[model samples]
Target chain A: MLPGGSTSVTTSMYSDGMSTSDRLIESTRELLWERGYVGTSPKAILERAGAGQGSMYHHFKGKPDLALAAIRRTAEELRASAEGALGGPGTPYERIEAYLRRERDVLRGCPIGRLTMDPDVVASDELRAPVDETIDWIRERIAGIVEEGKEQGQFAATLDGEEIAATVLATVQGGYVLARASGSPAAFDTGVRGLLSLLAPHSS
Target chain B: MLPGGSTSVTTSMYSDGMSTSDRLIESTRELLWERGYVGTSPKAILERAGAGQGSMYHHFKGKPDLALAAIRRTAEELRASAEGALGGPGTPYERIEAYLRRERDVLRGCPIGRLTMDPDVVASDELRAPVDETIDWIRERIAGIVEEGKEQGQFAATLDGEEIAATVLATVQGGYVLARASGSPAAFDTGVRGLLSLLAPHSS
Candidate 1:
């Protein structure tokens, strides 16, 4: 409804029957994923969403506000994706492996992980809380599973759940960095495989 | 020598009798580290370096050319730093631990790893080469030590050197992402500790 031109040309759902605010937030999410917070701009969001400047101001305070909405959405989505695997039926190791092997655009990198590289995201508490919460949520979830694994004797009883959880999280996030840096998914796969090898019992 | 401001006014090492090329490359490196390739601009580089706009174009073709020079320098510096620890005296695990525990600006993140998040850097082959090569070089270096550990009976002979090396690299790179996201170095230390635990033999 709020548009420079008709919504027919723009591929994004921004100009659809959706609320102007929702459209802006969705557009911001995509931009943030591709260009990050520092690289994304207000004009680009408007252009990509086919929404005009007035609509953006009317819906949200500014770029940062819209970005917050987008970032929160991304965090929720990430948690959902992770939960799908972590909460699925399996041993702790299997669940962890499933989460690690979840379909990912290796070259694109993690949306949350990529944000950490953005100075603006780290500089603002308002912007950083969702990221911090999401990471903590994941670490806690993985730690719970790891503890369960230890209790079941699936893992070494002496294993530290929180530390193992942190390592697992690190492997995935760092895999994206390595993959993107090399412009190949091989580096990511290698990292994951290496971690798995270390995780397995010596007999396995 | 080429500048629009008095040498004393500028804080960087621009007018310290350094060659224009060196000044340009150094300025580009610092800017790239802080702002990334897309966020950094030629004008900003010149201003920061206290070099004239004319000198930038005269010394290099454009941003990409200057960026390549800067990226190569960063790659070299990173290699040197890694060598200092990886090539130092110790058992393979000890050397690996030293490299992982080396002093770093945990909040600032890895200079090369940060570049992978930049769309401009990933999109260009030339810009990406140094990053790719640097990662490859480090992985290879780590793998060599791991191989030595296997031969020396410090590690399981069945271990894959390249794979373990990739995992170590991932832990460090991913640790930065977690630390930056949480605004604390605790996550980084946890990741390192977890990896170390996994590497040590259960009997030991």
Candidate 2:
């Protein structure tokens, strides 16, 4: 029934298929991880997505818009992954240990960590807000668990929940940077082990 | 008189001009902090250093050569600074605190931290070794202090020296990343304060 088309409206809708917006976002994520913000180009994004110039322009204003969407999506994935581990039932120590020991592609490096290194990415609030929110959310979530542990008499009475939480997060992130710089996972393991040992006496 | 030159060889020897190699290395360090390895260009280095094309090429073969020199210089500087702080006289705990509370331009981020974010820099051993050495040196230095504290009966007998040292380095490096990401110095202060509190009981 569509004008100048032989197919029915439903068929035409099915034929139009893949959403250009989704394709653009997926392409942006991959490129951003591989090349970072300053290295990625609009042309590269369009080509990788297999979407024409007009289709991309129609879906997103430009590269920055597409990048913001990509960064937000990355942030969501990071939050979901952290919540999955932190929100589970366990002692605060157990939950934190699980989060640290969770299987990770250590050599590939953290996507958020990669973004932080990009000067252009960090300079823009639109790009950085999601990254900041993700880390902040993580620190707060961990701190909450530590607070509950303190109340339950699991951690030392003198323990500072917020500071310990900050220390925990900093260790993991700093571990990644150390591991990558050393070209081995030894430093990362050493750091994590060191943190775990510090928490061992506090575990229930 | 030397060969066909009018000036004596002694005249050339008396000149205090910085060698082309030294100028190139210094310029690369500044650019690396601002633009990272992937973003900085040879032309930019030469222009910034006020050295000509022939001068740069005559001293260093290419960008990689120049980068190696800069990395080594940065590593040496990091070692010297740590020694200056960690080598001072005090109770081990006091010395550690001095190192932690030492003035820093937190927002500038650690020069080595900037390198870890650069994908290309991490991929090259010639560039990454110095970064690793700098961090390892810090951890060992601090670990020795913690050990000395334990020996002096300053810290609890149960303390883990190496672990605490790892935590110290990790917190500072991680704090910089968090602060830069959030565009606030509060995160840095929070991490530092938290770390200091952890060591509070050890102070005597």
Task: Please report the candidate that would top lDDT against the real structure.
Answer: 1
Query: lDDT tens digits, residues A54-151, model 1?
Result: 88889888899999999999999999999999999888889999998888888888988899988888889999999999999999999999999888
Model 1 alpha-carbon miss at residue A159, Å: 2.4
The lDDT of each candidate is 0.87, 0.76
Q: Give every collision pair in model 2.
A: none
Each model's Cα RMSD = 4.1, 9.6
Residue B133 miss distance in model 1 (angstroms): 0.3
lDDT string for model 1 (B62-131, tens) is: 8999999999999999999999999999889899999999998887888898999998899899999999
TM-score between candidate 1 and the true structure: 0.93
- How does model 2 score on DockQ? 0.37
Candidate 2 chain A, run of 10 with poorest lDDT: A1-10
Among all candidates shown, the one with the greatest TM-score? 1
Q: After superposition, which runs of candidate 2 have C-alpha atoms over 4 Å from their true positions?
A: A1-20, A47-56, A201-204, B1-20, B156-159, B202-204
Off by over 4 Å in 1: A1-8, A11-15, B1-9, B12-15, B202-204
Range of the 10 consecutive residues with the lowest summed lDDT in candidate 1 chain B:
B1-10
> What DockQ does candidate 1 have relative to the true complex?
0.79
